[model samples]
Target: MTLPIDPTALAGLVSRQIRTGERQGMPTKIAIAERTYATDPDDLWNALTDAGRIPRWFLPISGDLSVGGRYQLEGNAGGVVEECEPPKRFAVTWEMGPMISWLEVRLDPAAEGTTLELVHEAPVDPDMWKQFGPGAVGVGWDLGLMGLGLHLDSGAAVDPATALEFPTSPEGMMFVRTAATGWADAAIADGDDPALARPAAEATLAFYTVIPEEGTQS
Candidate 1:
């Protein structure tokens, strides 16, 4: 279904940035992006931390959330909460089966409201990185941020089925295109060759917005 959202205004609500850094003994890189929300740090923190509120915007999350605890997202990754600093920052291990990644989030109070920055680091799989660049993970975060914005604005639970089906929808493709282009810009800013990164952005966009074949799920 097509959502009633302004592609232009929606595009203006957030920004994307990317940077790469090394890790110990692994061929890996990290991507960090920040999105500013028109809300206080405490409110944004609550939205991110409160289990009751999480499923409204992001996914239905369970398990312990304190430092040294484990948390799981319904139908998604579950990991150890490595650090927690209330309304400012949190760090966790994002694990799905044998694959492992690290995710960190920081909130900074700003004139516009609160700036939420997410850092996701994963061991680079040469082939996958070549296929999608930063947008592989960047675009996923973009969708989560969009859902957070919607929930913050309306305080309504998003329909999961609808959210899943969105990317293949017409207006949804427009939003996806905007997100993909933003990531291309970010990659270029990080010194990636545009010849490679731009096409990776397109690959990422196509991956996110393409229709699934009959009887197969996205």
Candidate 2:
């Protein structure tokens, strides 16, 4: 299930940022990831907004996608589409269990291609943040962005089973470690203590690439 590309190079392609903000009057932590894809805005937009094309790179999604409509990703977050601007931007509520967060994706023309920016904002959980920093979710998005890049380059769907097994693969672990470290660096730039943030990044790496016993949870 190892990707055909250099995991380190692929992990380096993204830019990460950590922002402190307020959401619904509560303190929030925002993780932003940006990368440019080698495709025009129109083509990239279609690949993102088209339901039939979504599962090619990410999870299978179901539900309405228009403004105010609800959508669900299989075994993952489900939320309402809050805004939409074709070939430019879209926003949604990312809800899992009782926790609700905001996710927005923006696309713009870049010198090389179309730049995709993903912003995820959520109310901070002190213990969780202390244990994993932004990489808790940032690393997951990094993996998704990598999948998107592969799909764009190959013009084909990534193998679902392989993707599911990827995190435990040698190359997948390498990619996760690199991306997690990147998130830690971004957090440090945002005022997190370097000593603490580095450990959190290691925690995030373990969370993503660890394989659990057959009868126990991770």
Judged by TM-score, which candidate is best? Answer: 2
**For this target, which candidate reaches the highest lDDT against the unseen true structure?**
2
Candidate 1 per-residue C-alpha lDDT over 168-209 given as tens digits, one digit per residue, 9 for 90 to 100:
888778888888888888878978888998899899999998
lDDT per model vs. reference? 0.85, 0.94
lDDT of 2 by residue, 69-174 (tens): 9999999999999999998999999999999999999999999999999999999999999999999899999989988998999899998988877888888898
Q: On a 0 to 1 TM-score scale, where does candidate 2 land against the true structure? A: 0.97
Q: What stretches of model 2 exceed 4 Å from their correct place?
A: 215-218
Report residue 214 deviation for candidate 2 (angstroms).
3.8
Candidate 1 lands at a TM-score of 0.93
Task: Give the TM-score of each candidate.
Answer: 0.93, 0.97
Q: What's the number of clashes in each of the models? A: 0, 0
Scored by lDDT, model 1 comes in at 0.85
